[model samples]
Target: MQQVRAVVAKAKNAPVSIETINVPDPGPGEAVVKVQACGVCHTDLHYREGGINDEFPFLLGHEAAGVVESVGEGVDTVAPGDFVILNWRAVCGRCRACERGESWYCFDTHNAARKMTLEDGTELTPALGIGAFAEKTLVHAGQCTKVDPQASPAAAGLLGCGVMAGIGAAINTGAVGRGKSVAVIGCGGVGNAAIAGSALAGASRVIAVDLDDRKLRLAEKMGATHTVNSRETDPVEEIRRLTGGFGADVVIDAVGRPETYQQAFYARDLAGTVVLVGVPTPDMKLPDIPLIDVFGRGGALKSSWYGDCLPSRDFPMLIDLYRQGRLDLDAFVSERIGLDDIEAAFDRMREGDVLRSVVVL
Candidate 1:
């Protein structure tokens, strides 16, 4: 075991603190990562707010890039000194999803067999099974996907979660392709990435909808051909008007709210796809849409889990694109910070200007 400085949310609605914690040496099928950079994502904030669970004294940070420091016996997927993006979905090859060759939906994901603990020996529940907000973190060997060393750690780390979810929502779940008309609701980090993904997939038109003008502008930078300030105009009407009055071919609800989902449902053309990538709370139920409407809309309604990505296949490819200048991973990084600045970063995230504030260890 080794002691490392890490960010921890000790209690509900409390400020995160930097504490020295014990990171166990890798057991079988596990590896220890020397974290380079980790993005301060909203999910971490959710853990801190007790929205995720009563998993207090939580080790909070995931979306991360790092270098493998050590590996346990039989771990050959990655080795020490390799640069990697840490992923939570470490698919087990024996799972039913893997048996069917749909490992991206792997029913059983992998995490470290042992636990990281506080100085007082309290076991810490890592957010999303990855607590990358530390100097070093222990994870399943399958969780680290080796990427090009040239890619910026700050930028590459974002791909571990939100950016991947957004891009995957468009390209994977939505099946957006050349000549498709796409509209993404909620131009936050995830929504903007969806816009970028649609454009990358050669979408003829990409519309970004948001109540915030600032986010809409950022969406444009991320490849939205048109922007709709939903507060000022009915998004569904504008989307249909923009898409030659038939509505978009694919409408993604990145907002994860009933109203925005309704907008997405109504904003798409007949038989168009609706992809919901945004996460909603448990108490929030689906909106009251007519059963006839559901039947009439013949296309798929899907929810994206980690953008439906296979980390091993997607991470390296996306990093290659990032290095080649096609995917603007760097644009998602609003600022670079250190471990101690996490609480302030969380506050800034609520303000809605920052796309991502990454912690560089």
Candidate 2:
């Protein structure tokens, strides 16, 4: 048994407590990772709020960078000392989606069978199959994606979740390419990442829309050619005006609200693509939209799951890009704090004060 300090939400809506937890020895399919850094993502907050499920005493961190400390008997994909990024989705080769060669949508993913528990023996539910806020986390070997070790952990860990989702919304779901016009609504970590992805993909005009001018300015640094403060102006109208009276070729909704979704739907050129990467709450309903407009638009509507990322394929490449100074992953790391600062980080996130507050263990 390995006893380690970890951040855990003991009950619904309770502040996380830092405590010593017992992590069992790796089982047949597990590996233990010494977490180096983790990003405070909104999904972790959702889990703490009991929005994801009823699972309690959650080990609440997922977007992380770590080093392999040990492996189980049959683990071979990664070994001790390997530098890795932890991903929640671990593709199972025999799943129906994998059998069809669409491993990105693999229905059955792998997670560690071993359990990490509190000192009193209460089992802890890991956040998104990866309890990474701790000094060390246990995970399925496949959850560990190897990447270039030279990249900063603060920056690379963001790719494990929100950043990858945004980039994938454009490149994978929207199929954004060179000279295509693209607009990203919502300039948070995910939205800005989409804008950056659009720029990297060679989109000719990348327009960013958001309510906060602070976020808009940050989006500009991420490669948006134009920004519209949605609070001050109508985003759909501005997007159309910026694109020569025609809507953009692609629009991404990273806000996941009815208003933002509507904007994304109408801000695309006829036959253009709309990609939704933001997750909506369970009770949020789609606004009344005309079915005729949906049919008349003649465009694709796609939802990106983890940015449609194949971690093994995308992580290494993106890290290399970051190393080459092509992708500004570092721009998203607003501040780095110790593991004890997660709750404060959440507060900062709630107040829209930072893109990402990283926990550097």
Candidate 3:
């Protein structure tokens, strides 16, 4: 066992603190990773707020990139010294989804069998089973996907979560393609990523809708052909206008709110796709749209899970694109920070002051 410094959320709504936690050596089917960079995502804040569950003293931080330090017996997929990005979904190949060739939707995912602990032997539940905001973390060997060593850990790590979700929402779920018209509602990190994905896929018109002009400007940098300030104008109407009195070919809602979802539902052209990548709270009810309208739309309403990505296939390809300057993964990283700055980084996230504050070890 080894003790490492890490960030932990001790209780609901409590400020996270740096703690000395014990990480065990890799057991069967597991691996130890020396985390190089980890992104501060809203999901980590959600865990801190008890929004995810009542699991206290939660080890926080997931989206990460690292170097493999060691592997347990029988692990051959990766070895020590390999540069890798950690993924939450370690798909179990025997699951029904995997048998059906839809491994990305694997119902059974794997995690390290051994638990990290506090000094008193209190077991720690890793956030999303990663808990990578440390010098080192142990995970299921499948969680570590090797990528090109030339990629920047700070930028490449973003693809482990938000950026991948956005791109997957566009390319995988929405099926956005050449000459398509797309409108993304939100303009946050995930939303901008969708805009970027749409552009990369050769979409002719990419519209960005957001209440914050600053985020809209960032969306432009991510490849939005037009911007919509929803606070000033009706996004649905404007989207239709921009698409030549029809509507966008694909509409994505990254805000995960009822109002924004409604806008996305109505902003697509007839037979167009509506992709919901935003996570909604339990208390938030689905917007009431008549069954008649749902039938008349004649289009698909899809929910994106981890951007419907197959990490083994997507990660390396995306990293190569990032290396080639075809994709701007670096733009999502608003700042680089140390572990001590996480509490302040969460504040900045809530205030919408930054896209991502990455922890570089």
Candidate 4:
């Protein structure tokens, strides 16, 4: 076992503390990663707030890139010194989804069998099974997807989660194609990434909707062709006006609220897709839209889990695109800080001041 510095949340709605934790040697199908960078995502904050679960003393931080330090006896996919993006979804081949050849929807995923413990020997729950806010972390070998080493860790790490979710929501779930029109609701990190993904997929018109003008501008920089300040105008109507007075071919709701979802439902052209990539809370209720509207919509209303991405395939491809300068992953990284700044980063995230604050380990 090796002692590593990590940020841990001891209780719900409480600040995280930086402390030393013991990471065990890699066991079967596991590997130890020397973390290079980790991004502060909303999910971490949710976990800290007990919104995710009552798993107290949660190790918070998931979106990450690192170098493989060691691998277990049976691990062969990645070796020591390989640059990798850590993924939360470690597909278990025996799962029903994997048996159906849809590993992306793997019902049973793998994590480290051994636990990383606090100084007092209390077992710690690594966030998303990746507790990457540390100098080192242990994970299932499948969770470490090799990527281009040339890519900056701060930028590439974003692809491990939010960026990938947005891109895959458009490219895979929404099936955005050449000359298609796409409108993305909520222009935060995920929504802007969707806009960029739509552009990369050859969508001719990408409309960005957000209440904040700042985010809307950033969305345009990320390849949105049109911007809608939802605070000033009705997004559904604006999207229609921008897409030839009809509606978008794909409308993605990156904001997981009933209001935004309703707008997304109405902002797509007939027979077009409405992809929900954003997460919703249990307290939220759906609108009483007539069942006739659902039938008349004539298209799929899908929810994308982690954008339906197969990490092995998508991670390297995205990193290659970033290298080619076609996909600007760097734009998503608003700032970089150390692991100790994670709590402050959470404050900034709540204030809607930055897209992503990465921790450079």
lDDT of 3 by residue, 229-255 (tens): 999999999999999999999999999
Clashes per candidate (backbone, < 3 Å): 0, 0, 0, 0
Misplaced by over 4 Å in model 2 are: none
TM-scores for every candidate against the unseen true structure: 0.99, 0.99, 0.99, 0.99
Weakest 10 consecutive residues of candidate 2 by summed lDDT: 147-156
Pairs with steric clashes in candidate 2? none
Off by over 4 Å in 3: none
Q: State the C-alpha lDDT per candidate.
A: 0.95, 0.93, 0.94, 0.93
Cα lDDT, model 1, residue 265: 92
- Which has the higher lDDT value, candidate number 1 or candidate number 4? 1
RMSD of each: 0.6, 0.8, 0.6, 0.8
Q: How many times do residue backbones clash in model 3?
A: 0
Native-vs-model 1 lDDT? 0.95
Compose the digit string of candidate 2's lDDT tens values, residues 1-361: 8999999998889999899999887889899999999999999999999999998989989999989999999888999999999998999989889999889998999999989999999999999999999989899999999988888888888999988989988898889999999999999999999999999999999999999999999999999999999999999999999999999999999999988999999999999998989999989998788999999999898889999988999899999999999999999999999988989999999999999999998
Compose the digit string of candidate 1's lDDT tens values, residues 25-67.
8999999999999999989999999999997899999999999
TM-score of 1: 0.99
